[model samples]
Target chain A: MAHAHESNTKRIWIVFGILSVVTIVEVILGIIKPESLMASVLGMKILNWIFIILTIVKAYYIAWSFMHLEGERGSFKWSIVLPLLILIPYLAFILLVEGNYIYDVYSESFVSWDF
Target chain B: MEATVNTQTEEENVWGGGNQPLGASYGKMMMWFFIVSDALTFSGFLVAYGFSRYKFIDSWPIADEVFTHFPFLHGVEAPMYYVALMTFILIFSSVTMVLAVDAGHQMKQKKVAWYMLFTIIGGLVFVGSQAWEWATFIRGDYGAVELRSGRILQFVDAQTGKRIALDEFAQPIEDERVVHLERNGVWYQSGEGLPSYTVNEIKAGFMANENVVGRAEKLNEDGEKIMLSREETAERLESAVHVVEGANLVRNEYGNRLFADFFFFITGFHGFHVFSGVVINVIIFFNVILGTYDRRKNYEMVEKVGLYWHFVDLVWVFVFTFFYLV
Candidate 1:
């Protein structure tokens, strides 16, 4: 359990650089919002997908390096990460799909919402 | 009861108190449990935000247009710049926190104290930035008209395609209008403060200015706010009931009320977390200075707090992606 003899400062700086670079890329992409990527690929813009993917990468790196999950036993890491990995996406999917259905209903109804 | 003698070997006793499940200390395991539950709570909030956003997908305000202001830049249309900076500050702070934990592992008390101080400072800055962001969002720029159906109608230059503030063209009218205070009308029910311009003033202004057109909340094929034709603009203006200047629980100058609701709730909640994290970091910072952990020969307290700090940073990454970037 004692890591007093070894140095992890180099690895820490490298991860920080990686996270910063990814964030800068995300910001740049967001500002430019290239027309080609803005086109909807599967109900969402391709650019949005890129942002989400990059954000997940950043999240993973933070967890693995900063939180020291990478140094922990495999079972411990999985125990902490796997549940969120399964449940969050499932929850997002259900809410978004149902929300879209409700939107369709509003659009089709005779309420004349001044769209 | 046979004095409750142990019958099973340690290897066979899954619930044995002597064993560290998953090789984690009891404190670390409990922290993970708490983190998991807290993560689910945040996920619930984000999913609800997604649901509301999807339901009003077409009429949702463009995040870029709303969050364009930076601290020093007065009129520049720099979208996502300030948020990006905030993200960097948070991630860098997380780095500092890990450094503190590493130093703690090495029993370097002074280094841990300095790194923890940096982390606390970073957290305070991030929290302050979030407060500024909330203030900016609440006090909106370029006011809009709220229709009877609770829809917001903004104005844009017909030729330039740039948003125009109501103050630029609204012609003030001299009328015997008295603002109803708590002492005047319905003693128990006080009236809201008068908007900068009346709907009539806005309508008259729109009619007089040929260069200005009304933009509806809905988006068109190119992902731009749908602009109404001159005739449609006139028709829509007829339904305007009140002037919406900024955002609140009841109304938002930005298209949907739900957007403001989610924005306040989620970001406010996250800001609260950061605030508490700073407070905790400060407490730990003092402990490190007092050599409490140094005497104990372990700085696991710093490591524990570091885990929490990293979690906060992790959550912000998702919030930035979903709320701003996407």
Candidate 2:
């Protein structure tokens, strides 16, 4: 804990560099949108998957470096991160599945919605 | 009396009932707690957006086609460029904020103030950019027609496969079109003003234009908007109910109404956060100038606010991805 008092200016700029580079890459990939990466991997386009994963990487740098979660005690870090980690994915998973089901109903049912 | 005092001290040991259990101040810990809860609130809104998007997955608006405007680039197609710039601006501000916190750690008051000023300016620019984006979205590029089924139909030049504005093709029709207001109408109900061009004029002009075709919101297997053939376009024209120029809560020139709703709610909420963050940063800025933190011999207040600013940047990362990229 006492070692945290040292200057971390170098680390901060390094993380900033990482963030900038990642953002640039994401922008480039978005603009080009290569046909090869458009294939559906697991119900989503591979390009979309790449974007989400890169976003998570950027988020990790922001929280770990900018917010200084790296210096915090292990238990403290987990206490802050665990609930969000568990809950958000659960919520997204269930809701997206339900949404897909509704789409199935809208497409398959005899009822005509687009009159 | 000594035994009782010693027992009380033992009960309130460092890891037990001590106020600073994790070596963090109460205010800082509370900020983290608040951030966790706030993160959940934002995720809830985003997840709802995702749900709606999936429900209308086939007809959801393509982000690249939508956000293609730059600040001074008129009639140029540039997608993800301006938003990338906004992201850089925000991340730079986050950098300055962390630098301010670093300077505060070394008790450098002047550097902290200057860095705080930079952070505030960056936030203002980001918010201004957001306002511009909203305006551009509301004042859409090309006009679309709303069907009786509440679907959107866009006009495209069949030869070039490019979009054509309503003014370019829609012929003027002289008629007594009046806005429905409560004072003038007998029915005590009011609605929005009339569109610039009525459906009759659109149909007439569309019939005259030999190269223009209508495109539906549905996407084909290759992820392109399904374009109707000439016969299908003429048949679909009979179902036009309204001429939609831009986006609003109720309707949008974009494919889905839910897309506009989500775009407004999520970005509006995030903008509100940035606004409040600016206000808070300003208060702390003045305090730093007054040497309040120096007098207290602790720069933790600056650090606490830095946490919040970084969190704002963090949320924007997710939003930029979900809304624009994905």
Candidate 1 chain B least-lDDT 10 residues = B1-10
Candidate 1 lDDT over B227-302, as tens digits, reads: 8888888888888998999899889898898899999999999999999999999999999999999999888889
The superposed Cα distance between candidate 1 and the true structure at residue B249, in angstroms, equals 1.2
Task: Report RMSD for candidate 2.
Answer: 3.8
Model 1 chain A worst lDDT run, 10 consecutive residues: A1-10
Provide the TM-score of the second chain in candidate 1.
0.93
Candidate 1 per-residue lDDT, tens place, A30-80, comes to 988898897887899999999989988998999888888988878899988
- Candidate 1: which stretches are off by over 4 Å? A2-5, B1-16, B176-189
Error of 2 at A68 (Å): 0.3
C-alpha displacement of B138 in model 2, angstroms? 0.8
Clashes of each: 0, 0
